[model samples]
Target: MYILHRTNARPPLDIKDAEKSDTVHFINSRSKRQRINEKFDAAKSRIERHQKRWTEIGKELPPQINRRHISVISIGGVIGTGLYIGTATALIHAGPVGTLIGYMITGTIVWSVVISIGEIVAFLPNVGGPVGLAGLYVDPALGFALGWNAWYNWTIILPTELSAAAILFNGFFPNKHEDFIRQSNIVAITTMIFFAIVINCFGSRAYGEAEFFFSCFKILTIIALIIAGIAIDLGGGKEGFIGIKNWKTPGPFVEFRASGALGNFLGVWSSMNQAVFAFFGTEVPGVAAGEVQNPARNIPRAINRVWIRITLFYVLAVFVAGLLVPSNNPDLRGSASAGSPAS
Candidate 1:
């Protein structure tokens, strides 16, 4: 016999009795269907919650840059030491015409690559730049390699820039001792690096401002150089416009060994390599897409201008240098020994 407990609440029923009982039973036939439905509903809700969380996790980051800054910064980053120094070597290897042709070819290739990058960057501007794109469009491994390689390359470039700055300063102050110059250069570079880090730490606004001014200065400098070069070529002070006859006289292609077509081809290839290196930083603008203010507007504008800028700055500069100093000139041939005026 089962004794029923007397209380305000109803007493629990035995499993067999509850199944057979019809009074307010939660596990009855209809209740069983409700329980299954409830379970299904709960499982569906949990799956939805998980999916929502994943969507949040996978959301893209906001852009940090503006349009103007990106356009100018890209120009600044690309028109550095490579264009200034490396072009001379290319001009030496392949005469003016050969160098020009090589630049045209390489410039086209680089322009195509930049345009492709622009399309992707405009769609999804992000900080990781090309590496991020590669990961998304290509593979993770490739992205990792490209990212680290780029980081390493920039790391090495910093020290080299510092060294170059020191050399330039020493030229201005010839009286400075070698050891003193070296130490001073290290101190200066360290200070600049520290300041840059501080500015960057503040945020993107500061960086954008700094880049804007720096790029402006670079642009002005280039403009001045172009003007000065044009004046010099036209015989501004000493000589009068030296016309295009020099190009015709030398007949553009200069063979190192004078071995004919094959030799000339090899020489041109060597020069092409140098020219390609000179244009290495042309894609730096795309890297700035994340920071650009109006990426869609400025990125395409910047990318579109790359070929023109490269041709004008690099190819035109080389052409001028060739005109001012013939390819056969000792300076052009890079044969100036130690203490040589060209050196």
Candidate 2:
């Protein structure tokens, strides 16, 4: 141990004083070094403690999902319920041309966003993903902003999923009493929320499993719809020889609130928001960055497929949906809620 002493008395102005001043200077230097060492040790300990806590939490979590599961989820994430139901309204408002243009533009934007997130998160693995990257590479405040926004979005999306499904479940019992429908929605919504919570409790792997299967179903549904739409357009439906009939009659363009090229452009611009809402799930894989088994290998592979995800799955689906239904169809104007244009 080193002893530190403080003195107020001045050294006498003599040759003897020179030695005393040198001794005092050496003592001050030692004290300054000690203080620096103490601070460094304190900070190191805090980091160790924080890391320990994080490790404990990691231990409690269920088996982390691998690159493959996340990849499948990412591929199918674009097929949200909004695409099926909300596209009807978009068709009515923006018309087929506008909706198709909107999807293309938004697809480019979403592709950029996914690539950015993937690159950043891949370089800094086993961390908070985007939030951690933001703090490390940019300002800590940016991290906080992004983190809170993600939390808020996920919190709201869970309920929205349940509520939308519950309301749509009423189609089967159309003749049921109004009271029965109300009770059924309550029961269904609560059960769905409970099921989701239980999956979360099991861990991220369980959630991944659930989403994986659901995504499979969604992917199949989208594929089937595209096929069905093509068949329908090619006279496979009860209505014979309906090939591009809607497009020709509706003129492939409609002047929105204002009539002309500007209105057509505005229609596409306005539909961009609808496209964005459907695409919100495209970044879901970013949330699981910390637990990913192979960030370097998996992250880039999944991200590189952005073109396939957006163009093949989303852009194609929107194009098919546009071709299947005409803009003037009353169903597109909201008489048929939760029903697709083909229905």
lDDT for residue 45 in candidate 1, whole number 0-100:
62
Model 1: residues with Cα > 4 Å off, grouped in runs: 1-64, 170-199, 245-251, 256-258, 328-343
lDDT of 1: 0.66
Error of 2 at 41 (Å): 19
- lDDT (C-alpha) at residue 18 in model 1: 51
Give all TM-scores, in the order shown.
Answer: 0.70, 0.77
Q: What lDDT is reached at residue 225 by model 1?
A: 73
Cα lDDT tens digits, model 2, 130-171, are 676665456568888988988898788777777667655765
253, model 1: CA deviation in Å? 2.7
Cα RMSD of predicted structure 1: 15.8
Worst 10 residues of 2 by lDDT: 334-343
- Model 2 ranges off by over 4 Å: 1-63, 171-184, 335-343
Q: What TM-score does model 1 achieve against the real structure?
A: 0.70
Q: Judge candidate 1 at residue 198 and give its lDDT.
A: 90
What overall lDDT goes with each candidate model? 0.66, 0.73
